[model samples]
Target chain A: MEERIEISILLDFYGELLTDKQKNIMKMYYNEDLSLAEIAELNNISRQAIHDLIKRCYKQLLAYEEKLNLMKKSFEQKKIKNEILEELHKLNHQSEAVIDEQRIKKIEQLVKTAM
Target chain B: MEERIEISILLDFYGELLTDKQKNIMKMYYNEDLSLAEIAELNNISRQAIHDLIKRCYKQLLAYEEKLNLMKKSFEQKKIKNEILEELHKLNHQSEAVIDEQRIKKIEQLVKTAM
Candidate 1:
């Protein structure tokens, strides 16, 4: 799961950097689960071209992930933020704390704006 | 970030369930960033067909994600497991307790076998 998140972060950051053909090849093979021959026939390209595109896409994805470490840091920051939000929600729900519905609504509005 | 992970797992699981045409349409549009007319021309299909297929694909993807919630639970479980492993590694690093390198090696082997 950790690896998946890390991979995803790298994917998102470098996604714009990917060529249309390379991205299409990855989507066809990994996301769509299409066979190489199927992708080749569909796109009117050679099977070897599809194969090579996929390989290059994977290599680029890994390289960006390894060099930037963008995803891991982003995930950690998100995790912490979520934890703090949950605690805030919990506090709002507690009966002992002078429950202020108006304040809660205001806080929710602020959160929405920030998001 | 969380949404991306959730979307990814749902994408993976629902990806296996998508029809070839629907999946291909999604790939050409979202991942490939191709215009509808371009996809239609390339696939030798009508533009309307491509548009309809993409709409249906989005509907199915959302339905699968909402119903399954597979990604959310999986993410939580992974988070817990990783925290435990990190703690284990930290303990292994500290010499405060009688460190058993042999036991650690044995545990690593067991973990590999389990994986």
Candidate 2:
């Protein structure tokens, strides 16, 4: 993934663990693509302070990812969903020609609930 | 749920995060139904120490559940699976004579994955 997407993913998963001020700084810098000086000026902090805070937040987010691995589990689940979809397609296209709309819908709903 | 079952459920969801000794003590007490005295004797620790450690471990497990809610989620998922099964039963028994074995198995697999 791109660095920008990776940071946002980490933030999406664990940003609540950050303080409001720290989280705001991170959103501005990472999500908003603001320069350190721009963020520092907006928050009334030194550019160096903003730089250091972002550095800390980046490390903290990585640490949370390392410990929790919720991000990894999410990707694994997507893979499982794809695999299930393939199985459903095969089941529908089998030689028996037993494919029906109601059945497919019910099966799709079940897959929706599980994944 | 019974107290014993609840503890085991919490332990099952969050036990890996506990220290090996803490987890072992928990399993012995909750799953094995061992008294504090027996556990203390086994670990060569005082009964009071064992009691305190168990108290701490219980609090820690509850904290993990509070943060993660994985135990709560598992129960909720079980309920959803039951609901899906009910829907599936209705769909199978509906006007169409579509209660086939291969289709049912494939639909079951989808429910298995999502839940």
DockQ of each: 0.02, 0.15
Evaluated at residue B22, the lDDT of candidate 2 is 92
Q: For residues B39-107, what per-residue lDDT tens digits would candidate 2 score against the true structure?
A: 999999999998998899899888877766767866776665665556556545666554455545645
Tell the DockQ for candidate 1.
Answer: 0.02
- Candidates' TM-scores? 0.39, 0.63
Q: Per-residue alpha-carbon lDDT of model 1 for B1-115, expressed as tens digits? A: 6543444445664565576777777776766678999999999999998888877777777775565444554565455445435434543455554444443344344323222
Fnat of candidate 2: 0.04
Candidate 2 off by > 4 Å: A2-4, A10-68, A82-115, B93-95, B98-115
Clashing pairs in 2: A114-B114, A114-B115, A115-B114
Q: How would you encode candidate 2's per-residue C-alpha lDDT over A1-115 as one tens digit per residue?
A: 9977898888987787688899999999889999998998999999999999999999998887776676886777666556555555655566765545564564556455444
Q: How many backbone clashes does candidate 2 have?
A: 3
Candidate 1 lDDT by residue in tens digits, A2-113: 5445444555655655767776667667666789999999999999988888778877778755654545545654554454355345434555544343433443343333
